[model samples]
Structures are given as structure tokens and as C-alpha cells.
Target: MFPKAHQYVNIHAHRLAISQDEWVLTNLFAGDDFPGANETAYYSTGLHPWHIKDADSEQLIKKVELAAENLKVLAIGETGLDKLIQTPLDLQLQVFGAQVEIAERRGLAVIIHAVRSYNELIEFAKVHQPAAAMIIHGFNGSFQIAEDLMKAGYYLSFGHRLLISDKLKDVVTHIPAEKIFLETDESEHGIRELYKVVSELRNISLESLKVMIGENVKQVLRIR
Candidate 1:
């Protein structure tokens, strides 16, 4: 947990920017360089599907394992299936499963990047039944798909897209508060703005929404 109180928490972000002590969980891909340590932020690192084609499979897995052991690294991914990418589904599945195993071993939650592959991920979740929390970041899927994942005990994270997509707005209103999260996810939007949008959609005050999401983050990441 951060030292500051009542700060808007960005559950996932890419580029790290200076903030007024707001909590942020920055994402780092497995085959790339780690972020600088000047900022106070939590991190999640894994092999993204877009880089899987050129990444060294063995070394990538080792890197994820090593990163997961870090106290500052609270989650295991930004990793999952992406059918739109050129990486073979088989290889994606293999790498995703390996990261899930590592997350399970280290007791860290996973931040998944799923695109056009919800069914595949759901099936994988059923088979693996991971003990660690699994959050699907940047989720903009159908309500049925969201329901399916929620039923399977996965959390759904909404990003800046929620502000523009009516479908996503509808989906967000119905998700249980306990199973929902909000993120910036490489978007330029402020986390506070995203929270306001979600608060209005859910018919709750921003403070209440932030408290709920903060608790969810604490529970999922096992933060004290």
C-alpha cells in the first residue's frame, strides 16, 4: 500500500509520469528494459504477445520468473492471448500458461491482456484454476463475455475506452463493484477523470467508487 491516503490508483499504466503521490502500477514487458527507479510505483512485467515472435522463449520465461520475485512487482502480466497479433495461438497459450504458473508460485495477481480470445482464456482459466487473482486489463468485451469471466472468478479492468464506448459503459454499470477496476492503460486520461466517469455510470460517488476499487486492488495484490 502507498503512504498517501485517498489517491486515485492506476491499476495498469505503461509510461510512468510524475504524480502528486498517486499510486500507479506500471507495466513492463518481459524482453524489454525495466523502468527507472526514480518514481514511486508498483509494477507488473511479463511477455506481451506482440513481442513473442522475436523474443527468446526460454529467456523470457526466466525473466518473468525473476521479476515476479521482486517486492515492488505486484502482478505477473500484461500477458495473454491476442488473436489479432501474428504470434501463433499455440505459442501464446504456452507462454501465458508459463507466466500463470509463475504467478501462482509467487502468489502474485496477474494482469492479462486479452484481445479477441476470451473463450480461449476462459477455458485456460478453468483448466488451470489459478489460486492467484487474475485481472483482464483493458477489457471491452461483450456483457456475456464479461459475465463468463466474472463467473469464473476473474476481475475485469476498464480503461479510457469506457468514456467513449456505449457498449463498455453499459457493461461497466452492471459489473459487481467487487469484481471491477479502472485503469489508464497507456491512455492520456487522468485516473481521477476515469474514476469520475465510472462513478457516474455506476450511480455512486467518486469516493465510494475509489474506496471499492482500492479495496479490490489491495485484496487482489495482497497489499497490507
Candidate 2:
């Protein structure tokens, strides 16, 4: 039998300063410096759309390929289309596509950062049909978009926005528990606080919500 979910899981955090006992997935930019050598937190590496200008496209792809081989790396993004960012959409698509290919090849999940480009993303997913699980992190889109992605077999991860976005709370309450996840995503809010908000929103106990998300994490990361 699988172990029961007992701790908060932060799917995407810029810093690794959270409590030691919680399960966290930290983000590492492909072109940036690696995390501290002594840090033992699990990580997800990709070429963030905002940082593409600072990296050599070819070399960054290679680095992401190499990083995916590490056992400590659980997923392959924080990478995806961001319409609001200055990076060109075509370039972002190229980078995001390459990372998706790498995640599929490496048997790791992906965490996407989509902004105002859900149609393009959904189209890409339809064409590529990537085998690895794909999660849209920091999701705050309309319920129709959420429903579309979930129907397409993509997971939607909500973050601090749930605390204030009534629309997001409605989405959380209606979406299947198996198709959702929660995160802090660089917010000042603690995972425990997010958990409390989500529990109340979903009308479920905090422990039950933890177990539900924990199971999703295990499946996405292919944890044993």
C-alpha cells in the first residue's frame, strides 16, 4: 500500500526556506546557477519564458536535458507560454516544446507557467500528446479553460490566488480532487495557510485535502 499523504506539498517555490518536514518542489532556471550543493530539496528545472533572453537557446536545452537525468529532479518546468512577458510567442513555444519533449523522454512530469495563451497550449498538447503528466501552475483562468485542460488530461495547480479569487474557489470546489493541486508559487503565504483556505473552499477537512493532494503529487512525480 502507498504511504498516506501527511505533509504540505509546495509544487513551485522560488526559495527553499520552507519547513524541513513539508514536501517541496523548488524551481531551478536552466540558464541560472544550480541550487546550493548541500540543499536536499527536490527540484524542477526548465527555461522560464521570462529568462530566455539571458540564455543561449541551444545550451539551455542541453542543460535541461542533462538536469532531467538527475534523480533529485521531479519535474521539468516552470516553463511555458507567457503572453504578457516580452519574449516572443514563437520563441516561447520552441523552448516550451523542447522541454516538454525532454520531460516525456525522461519520464518526468512538467509544471507549466501559462499566461493568456491557453488556446495555443491546448492545441500544442493535442498535437504532441506528451506522455508525461503536465500541470499548469498558478492557474487563474476561466472555468471553461480549466474544464478544457482537465478534459485534455492536464492537471491544474492553484496557488495563493485561491485566497482572494472567488472564481478560483468555485473552480476548486467543482473540479475533481484527482485533477487538482495547490502551491505557494513565490507567495508570502505559507503552504499551511493555503491548505487551510483550500480545505475551507472545498468543504473538506485539512487532512483529507492533504491526502488528496499528496496522492496527486506522488502520481505526478512518479514517487514510490
CA lDDT of each candidate?
A: 0.85, 0.84
lDDT of 1 by residue, 144-199 (tens): 99999998889999999998999999999998889998889888888888888888
Report the C-alpha displacement of residue 157, candidate 1, in angstroms. Answer: 0.4
Which residue pairs in candidate 1 collide? none
Native-to-model Cα distance after best TM-score fit, residue 146 in candidate 1, in Å: 0.7
Cα lDDT of model 2 by residue, 118-152, tens digit: 88888998988889899999999889999999877
User: How many clashing pairs in candidate 1?
Assistant: 0
Q: How many residue pairs clash in each candidate?
A: 0, 0
In candidate 1, residue 205 scores what lDDT?
88
Lowest summed lDDT over 10 consecutive residues: which window, candidate 2?
Answer: 32-41
- lDDT value, residue 142 of candidate 1: 88
